[model samples]
Target: MKNSVKYAVTGALAGAANGFFGAGGGLFLVPLLAAWTKLEERKAFATSVAVILPLSAVSAIVYWFRGGLDFMTAWPYLIGGAIGGIIAGRVFQKVNMLWLRRVFGLLILYGGVRAVLLL
Candidate 1:
């Protein structure tokens, strides 16, 4: 498939994942971008962030229209997330990709475990 088609399909899937899950498009996107497009790991990660930001905004707007979002409860997290994002962005280029991958994997594993156990 052409790169444009591949990217479109990947973006569709990521958007679906974000819309359905309220976030986590990057969880699907980062791996798909790295594997399917043969993008470098760090570039894949950065690209996922860029793509997800718009996907998330669209999703959030949809959720708000559907009365699924509570801005009052979300403000604290938004504030903290903004600060953390700034810090992460500033230091992102300096981080070791291997360790970043390890931490990402661990977080996914933890989330999976918690999800399964919660059920």
Candidate 2:
């Protein structure tokens, strides 16, 4: 497929999952990208991160302009997230993704439990 078609398909797939399951689809995305694209595991992951950055920034900008972002309140978490992202980026390549899948599964389970409880 052409880049445009690939992008459209990826965006559509990501959005479809987002609409149903929220951002946890990112975990789904990494593995799926690996499976779907010609990129290797590390390259696929990097590509996913590259794709996510602009999309997430645009999303945050939209929410911010729409009176959704609480910049002041979001600081502590954002700081921790940045630090964690750096650490994870360094270590993630060394870790086997079988373990990553297991960890992601736990997260999905946790989110499901939280959602059920909050309902």
Best-performing candidate as measured by lDDT = 1
lDDT of each: 0.93, 0.71
Q: lDDT tens string, model 1, 1-114?
A: 588888888899999989998777888899999998899999999999999999999999999999999999999999999999999999999999999999999988998898
lDDT string for model 2 (30-77, tens) is 776876665676676677776766666666676789887788988998
Question: In model 2, which residue pairs have backbone atoms overlapping below 3 Å?
Answer: none
Worst 10 residues of 2 by lDDT: 16-25
Q: Estimate each model's TM-score.
A: 0.91, 0.76
Model 2 C-alpha lDDT versus the unseen true structure: 0.71
Could you say which candidate leads in TM-score? 1
Measured on C-alpha atoms, candidate 1 has an lDDT of 0.93
| Candidate 1 off by > 4 Å | none
Backbone clash total, candidate 2: 0
Consecutive 10-residue window with the lowest summed lDDT within model 1: 1-10
Off by over 4 Å in 2: 2-6, 15-22
